[model samples]
Target: MPSPAAPAHPAHLSPALTLLLATATGLAVASIYYVQPLLGLLSAQFGVGSASIGLLPTLTQLGYAAAILLLSPLGDRFDRRRIILWKAAALVAALAFAAWAPGFGALCVASVAIGLMATLAQDLVPAAATLAPEAERGKRVGQVMTGLLLGILLSRVAAGSLAAVAGWRAVYGSAAVAVAALMPLLWWRLPRFVPATQAGYGELLASMGRLWLQHAPLRRAAMAQGLLSVAFSAFWSTLALVLAGPDFGQGSAVAGAFGLAGAAGALAAPLAGGMADRRGPQAVIRVAALLVFLSFAVQAVAPASLWLLVAVAVVFDLGVQAALVSHQSVVYSLDPASRSRLNAVLVSGMFVGMASGAALGSSLLAAFGWRAVPVLGAVAALGAVVVSRHGRRA
Candidate 1:
């Protein structure tokens, strides 16, 4: 029998290619988060209650979760380059629709579409893993993850600042233009990926369930990371509301500026990746989760103190980003041939937690007030620590 066909177009990851992957991942994922800082503004403009406006991010994250489960696995069955380009075009359209949305209902529809298309970011990540040599996989994944983390953190800053000056619509318009410009560059640069499997789409998706069951580590990583995401998402989704309330008397710009505090988390990504490579991801996960728990616990005590909140943001953001990088390293190592499907399983869990957190954060904020938000985050993060430790013992 013929030797199994070598995975097609296998090439070492060049510096230029790494940079492209990182930039592409950042831009794509950023699209999902641009509405976060603008939630307060959106609530006011739409004349809706806090819980209702919170549904926007919840819908976007739910869309992302749906796409990760439904679309990301296709990378293993098709040329990732083709998938990226097609998704990029669709993402541009979605962003444009969001910008031109004439009503709150239209914007909600656009948010879901944007989340679905932004799974291109998920594609770029596994592509990075596929390109890198095994020894360098963790570090390279970390570098790409750094871009993803920065995109998430900085998008809030850009959206809030731009929304303050030009209105929220301008933020979406500019993002659409950015994604459009990115397409030609991606077309010119990204190499064609050899499809990893010829399995039909149904089989490909079914494989994800098998992978989840076959790999205990994958499940644990997904669970811990998912819990951490609850803390991270809850904090960000509710932050603007907390700042805008009578206690702080701030606006979107100030809310956006908080992203700068979390910039420290961006810097921590590569370090976390390297640490996972050196010490293993389990220790990293436990320590990182504890850090998140502690940071949020402190924030719960002094929720109204701006300076304390800034410090809490820096520490917790660092912990959350570190845990994510470590989790990716764990999942990517499990099944090389099924990297895309494995990632789909891992990130699907994460976005589910994000959707839950956004909804829960908004409800908690509305019912009990801002003080309750941090407590929810603290509880979720502590649960991550317990899960990580339980995985180790098992």
Candidate 2:
């Protein structure tokens, strides 16, 4: 039997198709984040404690994590296009349901459903990787990732603006309408591809464990990105509190506006992809590590001017996102048949890192001060640099 890792040179994906895939991925993934900026409004409307309302985003993350582990591997055992379409449909329904949900309990259920189906982004990413030639694989994945990043950064903007104008529920309603409209475009444009693996569902899932134990490159890529994610999460998680301190005396709105600066950094995704193609993904990761380290180092030295902090957000996102694209490029190259499962493992690790970083960042900020937060970020990025360097030598 021929190896699945051997290049097939898939020629069906056109530029138009690629754009649609990227857009679809961006829109699908945005659903999980829309609630973050509306938590206070949700608490007021639902007559709930702010602490209880926090469960909306928490459950969404939990659902997304579970879906990545459970549903993502199905792409290898079935048709990826079908998986994407089915999940997109579920996502549309979930969004609409959340919009109309009568109470907190119903909204919580809908939020989980939305998260579970948001794996559509995960499915599209691996599909893009599989469709591109080995030489251009990083570039293609980067294109899709750029959209994914834009969606994450912009979702807060859209949600906050819409909530101000209409109300919190209107945000979800608008998203549902947009997603419903996107379904036909996806159905019309998506290219279908058959899976090579004939393994039963149970066996397919079991193989994920074997793949983890078997591939050194996969493990390295996951570890490197996971560490970088810790730094990324640490910054964003405590940013609002830091801004609210006496020196800054800003509010969450100011913190939210900083996402626009971060969006500027996502533009590097395609460029990083192209570099990974030419110089190898490891080289891109090396540059990314250095950029992340420098971003924090500057923050530690320079006092926190708002403009300076904006620049820091841009630089920090640029480095972390570049490393992410480079890491995915390496993981996708490991096995053609297992790209989706590989992504599941790699992304799962990132989530774990983000959760840990959020908790640690919060603790550090409370115990010490805003000054302590950057030191934690710098140390985490330094850890990422060490891991990437070791991976390079390996």
Candidate 3:
């Protein structure tokens, strides 16, 4: 019998179909990130402090953690398509609530719900991993990952750009329709996976702990990605502030343009994934770390130049997406029996890092100034780089 990881490609599925689904995945997940770039505007409109506005993002992160904590393990228990459909349903509801949200408090409540619902992507991933053909899993997964990363990067602009034209509420309202439209396509196109009927939730939770304890690669990847996520989050969390400064004094639309800049790096995600397939994830991680260090170094020194910032954005994004794909490629390979739980653990760590980074960036901006925050960011990026090397060596 041929092994699951054998050399033959799974071209049974159409590339166009796969790419379409992957792009849909990215679009859906991007909903979670739409608010980050708009926090400043939200703060201004809601008459809240920056920290209070920050709650918009904080709640989303926690909600993601909570959803993954509870729902991801279900991937092992039932059809992943069910999980995806249900998640898409909830996302539409969440977007509706966010659209109609009356105040900061209401928006925060809606944000949490959105985050929780958006985590359906976490469940969706194991499904994507399973659908990927054996020999080209990394490349296939990478193609899916491109959409995920695009969702993350592009949604930033979506929020800002939308807010610039209509109101802040309209942006979220539009996401409602987008998510709703996706449900049918996914329902029709996604393949089915037979879930384990044997394991209970308690058993799954226990296994999550064991997965964390027993697998060095999972643990290392989680920590490294978590830290890098914090760095990435910090940059994004304060992007509006930087652009709104005297140097550029840009509006939300102009600020959103930076998302286009970050697209350069997002475009690199599939390349990194394919490379990981050929060279092994360790090499990919090592190379990604170098890119991160270079990007951060540039950010720290060239605070005044928009073109420099744009170039650095590409490098930073490249490092982040490359590192993430590398980690996912490795972790998804562990314990086919519990890939969902593994993803939950790995993604939850990123939530922790994201919340921490947003808070850290906000605090530093309030105290030491925006210029100083990227110094710490550069340090964080370097720290992640070193950690990645140690993980690779060990």
Model 3 pairs in collision? 26-147
Name the candidate that leads on TM-score.
Answer: 1
lDDT of 3 by residue, 281-300 (tens): 98998788678777777777
Question: RMSD of model 2, in Å?
Answer: 5.3
Give each model a TM-score: 0.93, 0.82, 0.89
| Model 2 Cα lDDT, one tens digit per residue, 116-171 | 99878998887887788777776777788778888888887777667767887888
Query: Per-residue lDDT of 333-370 in model 1, one digit per residue for the tens?
Result: 88877776787888899999999999999999999999
- Which is superior by lDDT, 1 or 3? 1
Residue 155 displacement in candidate 2 (angstroms):
1.8
Q: Of 2 and 3, which scores higher on TM-score?
A: 3
Shift in Å, residue 136, candidate 3: 6.6
Each candidate: RMSD to true structure?
A: 3.8, 5.3, 5.0
lDDT of each: 0.87, 0.78, 0.78
* Backbone clash total, candidate 1: 0
Clashes of each: 0, 0, 1
